[model samples]
Target: MTTFTALTTLDGKAPAEALGAAMEGLDPAPTGVGVFEMEDGSGLWEVGGYFDAAPDEVALALLAAAHGARPFAVSQLPEVDWVAHVKRELAPVEAGRFFVHGSHDADKLPEGRVGLLIEAAMAFGTGHHGTTLGCLRAFDRLLGAGIAPRNVADIGCGTAVLAMAAARCLPDAQIIASDIDPVAIEVAEANLAANAMAGAVTCVTAAGFEADPLARRAPFDLVFANILKGPLIDLAPAVADHTAPGGHVILSGLLTHQAEEVGAAYARCGFNPVASDEIVDWTTLVLTKSG
Candidate 1:
């Protein structure tokens, strides 16, 4: 196991930053990867993993592809096995009736309780982040209120956490989960299988609701979009198009400051905001389409 640190110029940081953000929700995690915005307005990324050969070789390859930098300063951390450390840090959390773990723990779903093991690899929605957790809580509330969606679509379904939760909650419901990234689709499929839900959830690689076939199959009874603000705004109409009359939508992954803009986007799509929940800097909005 080895850890490598690489620095990037201001211009070189953008690609890696995007990749890091895309991967923040992966399960089993992704090589303990992270990008830090430096105080000097530059960027640095740290990656650690197990390697049978020279660690720098792999590190250089990743940096070259992500940051487009060659010979980017590589420093090794002595006496620290970062791969093991990260796996330990990402160990599963069992709280109350929910057992949350990385993809590796997928087979270890708790007995008699609904299991949601996500393998985020390099996407978001592993339930560790506050936004994901908030969405999960919101889903729980919806279920508690006896809101069982007959058709559900998890837009931007990074790792498919929400889709799986919905499937478990509504055993007879149809689920469609999609992500723009191919890697996320793979992870989501693995997660659905790990939760013994392969038969119930459909996973695909799609950028937005308009690009997904399931969205065209039937109007969704509920839709979950946990994407960034920009895409969320742009996809609002498509979301409305896929949602049935009087159907529900769960929107998250925005700062409180951005809620108004997001809400306005949905409102324009004929979704009336029913509730908004805030936790820390993140906000989750529940909206329903007007008949």
Candidate 2:
């Protein structure tokens, strides 16, 4: 297994400066930064980047830079062998009436459960992340309520997990799943097919609701966006415009503290908060459009 080291430094350098310096020795550098408040309420930032060096060397450099402040750490990530990892991680499982697994589990699905096998490369939404699980729980709640949505859209669909969940729940429903990343769209297609849901869900690559051709169909009974706060705030209008009268929207992936800002954005877009829940430090919201 190839190992890559991640070095986190804190010498009072600005985030950009620290990131720039960290990038010097790293190859195929970090894609983004993840910032969250520590348990003690102190802000913590994790700069994720890739490196081909020894983990100890990376750790020593980052730790030495801190000079005993203990604000730096290094961790190693196994270089992902996409095919092998995907196969193992997506192994089959039976959860009540729902059979859940990844594409690699195609031949192992247990009988007597509705099987949903997906193959999500690295595009998110394999039901592993907390946010994705939260959204799935929320979707399950809606399903339990016996609400049959005529149309559904999974915005920023990622690996199209939510969209697939919806399709599983509302088999007769019209559903569209979209993402800004073309790679994500490709993954979603594979995932849908692996689950034998290719015909039930349409996957597309789009910037947001505004840029999506399906948005013109308008007024979907259910819409979901599990993305970052910035994009969520910016896409409020498009979310509102595409949701049908008396429809509902589920938003996740925002910090609990950012809920107010996100709520206000949706309010401006004509959505009223129906419910809000928090898990860990993340917030999930359910909003409804007035009839």
Candidate 3:
């Protein structure tokens, strides 16, 4: 069946989310809705909805006007096997000791390197993105320096690839992966199973460190957060609180220019910058909490 989509862009997150929420009440209500900040540094948030059938153009127009968003662009998408398409286009990505690949490339797992199976699905962090790549490399560097964290948390984990990497390297470490989106948590669980690392890492749905599971496991020795700049900045204090003194945090999902500000935010929360790796337009930061 063909899918219909309506998309619009607005200036801020609140308005964009408001618009997405309104879309759910439409006459031909959307099956799903999404509100995401445009990654092009335009400061614009894109609100989109997917419908099994065509949505009411009039309702969409009114909602867009009400939310001060651009006029909704409605279109019908042809049915396609997105997973197969993605697998064909996405080659295995190698970052330091980690090799991220889809199931189709299972035979290509390199010799002696850690392999993480992450199929392209409704989540993020395939290691193809610069942010994910940089984070993996940063973590590898920490390992090279004799860092053996006994407790690890991956905040906003999309597919739990980072957490899985930790699990592969630190077999005895206690690891938990959390994301605000339930769908991402589901994907993370699936990926964990695909890697045959099921039950090796706990998965939870929570925003940042707000989940009880995370709070209960506090004072983590290492944390991985590859989220956007806004959320990353807001999470600094919470991350610092959950991390033990002298603990390490690997952060990414930042444009190169935004790295300085994000680093400064963590620094104010008692974190000292240890390393920064820039790849293309993205940068990954590694910081140590002050003892």
Candidate 4:
């Protein structure tokens, strides 16, 4: 069966959330609703709803008007087996000694290399993205340089691929994977279990390094943050606070042009850039904290 989506944008988080909440009460209520702040540096928040059936345009218009949002744009979406498509489309991604693959490509996992089983159902960090790949390669390079970190943290770890890599290579190290979205944490746990590394990496639902699980494990020797440019800049100070002197941070999810700014932010927090690699439009940076 086909589905329909209604989307609108409004200023302010409150109005967008209120509009999303209002959408839930409509007749033929939405199967899912999302209210997100657009990351384009545009001050707009997008409110969207998915319905199994066509939504009432009048109702949507009224809701938008009441919320001071633009008129809802509704569209029909074709029903497709997204999981199957992803499995077929995403082959194995190799970054140095790490291989990220779905179960469909399990046989392609090479010998003597660490294999991370990320299923197609998991929507984030399949390692196909340049940012994720860059982070993995950066870590691999560090390992080659004989940088062995005993305490590590993976902030905004969507699928926990980076954390898992650290866990596999540094079996004796303590690794924690964290994400603000609880759903991503669930995905991380699933991925960990799939890799038979369930207990190797602790999974937490927290923003940046705020929660007790992360705070108690402070002064990390290494940290991985594959999040967007804005959050990476905002997180520079907190990352510096939790990192030990001479600790390393592998940061990605930045456009090539944004890397310099992020590097400058970290520099102000006593971090010196060690390496900056650009893969496609994304840039991954490796920086070490100065004593």
Candidate 5:
């Protein structure tokens, strides 16, 4: 079946989210709505909605005007199996000792490296992104340096790939992974099972460390947060508070320009910078908590 989409962009996250929320009451009513900040350093956020029928342009215009967003661009999308398309485009990714791939590329997995099977679905973090790869490499570097955390948490884990990698390295470690969206948690669970870590890593539906499971496992020896700059900055203190003294942290999902500010944020929270790896347009930072 053909689907319609209405999309617009504006400054600030509040307006974008407001526009997304407003789209829910439209005459055609969207089947899904999303608001995301663009990573092109434009400080702009995009709000989009999917619909089963044609949307009223007048309603869209009014909503855009109210939210101070750009004029809505509506278009019909041809029916395409996006999952199959994603599978076709995704090849295996190797970062340090970690290997991420779909079942079709199982033969490509290196014999001695840690293998994580991540199906090509709507979820994110297949280890192909510079941010995810940088994070994995950071972990491997730390491991190589004889630093292994017994308790680890992957905040905003898209597919739980990082958590699974840690689990593979430290069989006895207490590992937890979480995301704000339940759908992401579902994807994480499936990926965990594919990696033979079904119940090894606890998957929680949460934003940051709000879930009871995370709070109980406080003072983690390591934490992985591969989220965007805004949340990374906001999470600095909380991440520092939950991390044990002398613990390590791997942070990514940031543009190279934003790395300094994010690093400063964590530095203020007693997380001293250890090392940073820049890959393409993104940079990942590894830090250690000051005792």
Candidate 6:
């Protein structure tokens, strides 16, 4: 069945969330509503709703106006098997010793390499995005240099792909992967099971490093944070506090232009950039805390 989407953006979270809540009371009620920040540090939040039937445009416009948001844009969307589309566009990705592929390409996993099974169902952190690829490569390069981390964390670990890679490389390491969205935590758990890593990495639902369990396991030898620039900048101090002396961090999910600013924030927290990877529009940085 086809669907319709009504979307609007506002300057702050309050109006965006209010608008999202308003969508639920529409005549042709939305199937779901979502509010998310733009992640660019623009302070803009987007409100969107999906509906099986076309939403009442007048109601949408009234809601937008009431929330001081831009006029809502509604459009019909064709039904799509997003997983199939993802599989078609994302071929197997090789980053250093890590081979990330969908089950359809299972036979392509080469010998003597860490294979990460990331089905199209979970698109984020599938090692296909430039950010994820850059992070994986950075991690592999670190391992290749004979540096081993005993304790690690994958913040905002969408599918826990990074954490799993570390698990594969350093079998005895303690790994914790977390995300604020419970759905992402669920996906991470499922991906871990699919890769026969059901309990290899501890999965948690928390915002950034806020989980008490993560705090208890502080001073991690390495941390993988592939979230966008805004949150990365915001979490710099906390990340630095949790990183062991001389510990390493692989940071990404920033555009090429945003890396410098994000790196500068972490630098203020006593981190020094050790390696940088640039792929197309994304940039990933590896940094070390001073011992």
The top-ranked prediction according to lDDT is 4
- Candidate 5 positional error at 269, Å: 1.1
lDDT string for model 1 (144-240, tens) is: 7878789999988888878888887788888888887788888888877877878688887878865647756669989899977777888887888
lDDT of each: 0.71, 0.70, 0.93, 0.94, 0.92, 0.92
Runs in model 2 deviating more than 4 A are 1-48, 51-99, 103-113, 120-123
The stretch of ten residues in a row with the least summed lDDT in candidate 3 is 116-125
TM-score of each: 0.71, 0.71, 0.96, 0.93, 0.96, 0.96
Candidate 1 weakest ten by summed lDDT: 39-48
The clash tally of candidate 1 reads 8
Model 5 lDDT tens row, 174-261: 9999999899899888888777788999999999999999999999999999999999999998998899999999999999999999
Candidate 1: residue 138 lDDT (0-100): 76
TM-score of 6: 0.96
What 10-residue stretch in candidate 6 is worst by lDDT? 37-46
Q: Give the TM-score of candidate 4.
A: 0.93
lDDT of 5 at 284: 97
Residue-wise C-alpha lDDT for candidate 3, range 197-277, written one tens digit per residue? 999999999999988999999999999999999999999999989999999999999999999999999999999999999
Q: Which pairs of residues have clashing backbones in candidate 6?
A: none
Model 6: lDDT equals 0.92
* 1-291 per-residue lDDT for model 4 (tens digits): 889999999999888999999999999999999998775556689999999999999999999999899999999998899999898899899999999999998998899888999999995799999999999999999999999999999999999999999999998999999999999999999999999988999999999998998999999999999998878999999999999999999999888888898999999999999999999888999999999
Clashing pairs in 5: none
Residue pairs that clash (backbone atoms under 3 angstroms), model 2: 30-49, 219-244
Which candidate would rank higher by TM-score, 4 or 6?
A: 6
Whole-structure CA lDDT of model 2: 0.70
lDDT of candidate model 5 versus the reference: 0.92
RMSD of each: 7.1, 5.4, 1.4, 1.8, 1.3, 1.4
